[model samples]
Target: MGKRVLITGSNRGIGKKLVEQFAQNGFNIVACARKKDDSFDDYLKDIVRMYNIDVTTSYFDMEDEQCIKRELKSVINKVKTVDVLINNAGYGQNALFPMISSNELKKEMQINYISPIIISQIVSRVMIRNGGGSIINIASVSGIRNEQGRLAYGSSKAALIFATKTMSLELAPNNVRVNSVSPGFIDTDMWNNRSEQIYKKVLSETPLGRQGNTKDVADLVYYLASDAASYITGQNIVVDGGRMI
Candidate 1:
């Protein structure tokens, strides 16, 4: 049996890519995503066949705290000890402050901030008992920079990043490392939906002159979860192609 990793939002985009990279690297994966029907099941089957690695799936609604707890409990029961946890399940709704609703704000906070913290708390207990583990929170460049339509989305990510720093301090003594990765303009479903003008502006500002691919983020995450980053913790590493500069 290989080391185990639990990744949330593993059915698509960056999460899906993370699963592939980790599976290729010989990690047994406990992939979590919303139950979207038979297609997701087929995809999981393909992933297991392609990587020849142990793969399991759990369905959960991040907006529902009870569902998150129940689903995570199921994973914990099956894996017993998870070596890595990647909090990659999140969505951004583009709306200016005036257009944003209270419901939207709450949902964003729940999914992007509160849910990850809860998942981390539960997984950290197992990690502590097992002597150590890594927790990586997928933050965003929008969290670091103020954007017009990211009132709720950006605030939620910023909170997650802060939570990562706090978790790192408390979990370090237990050998549980906590860190965050803030990606710039990644060409995922999230970016694909943006307007052409938004895309053009982002590319023009990005030193790389292009959006990053899923593998770009996945590779950095793999490194953080490996023994190579043993001494690293509580840091938010940005992978934005120098866009912040």
Candidate 2:
């Protein structure tokens, strides 16, 4: 049996790519998403057929804390051992400070900050029992730098980055590694949803002169979760193509 990895939000975008990458690399995958429809069902089947790796799908909703706890417990029972956990389920809702509603802010915090922390807490226990594991939180470059209309999203991700550092220190003694990946403008559906003007502005600002792809982030994440990064923990590695510079 191969080492097992549990990835949240694995139905699309970076999460989806991570599933494919890890599966292709010989890791048994526990792919979680908020919902599973016919399209995603077919996608999962295709992944299994193409990769020939064990792939399990589960439902996790970051919006509902109780649901998250219940679903995670069920997942733990089924998987038995989760060698790596990728906390990739989050949403980016941009809003200027004055225009940001309390409800939206709370929702973003719940999905981006609170939920991942909770998931880590539960999964870290499993890792501890198994002697060691890796936990990777998918943060964003918006957390590290200031930008217009990003008050809520940026603040929530900033909290997640800080939480990653703190969790690493606390979990290291137990042999579990905790880290975060902060991705900049990745050309996913989320970025495609933005106006073309926004894309031009971001491209001009990016030192690489282009947006990042899902694989760019997934490759880094796969390394972090592998033994190659055995000595690395408690860090936030950015994949923004030097945009922060």
Flag clash pairs in model 1.
Answer: none
What overall lDDT goes with each candidate model? 0.93, 0.93
Residue 173 miss distance in model 1 (angstroms):
0.3
User: Per-residue error at 80 for model 2, in Å?
Assistant: 0.3
> What's the lDDT for residue 12 in model 2?
92
lDDT of 2 by residue, 61-88 (tens): 8999899899989988988999999999
What is the C-alpha local distance difference test score of candidate 2? 0.93
**Regions of model 2 farther than 4 Å from truth:** none
Cα TM-score of candidate 1: 0.98
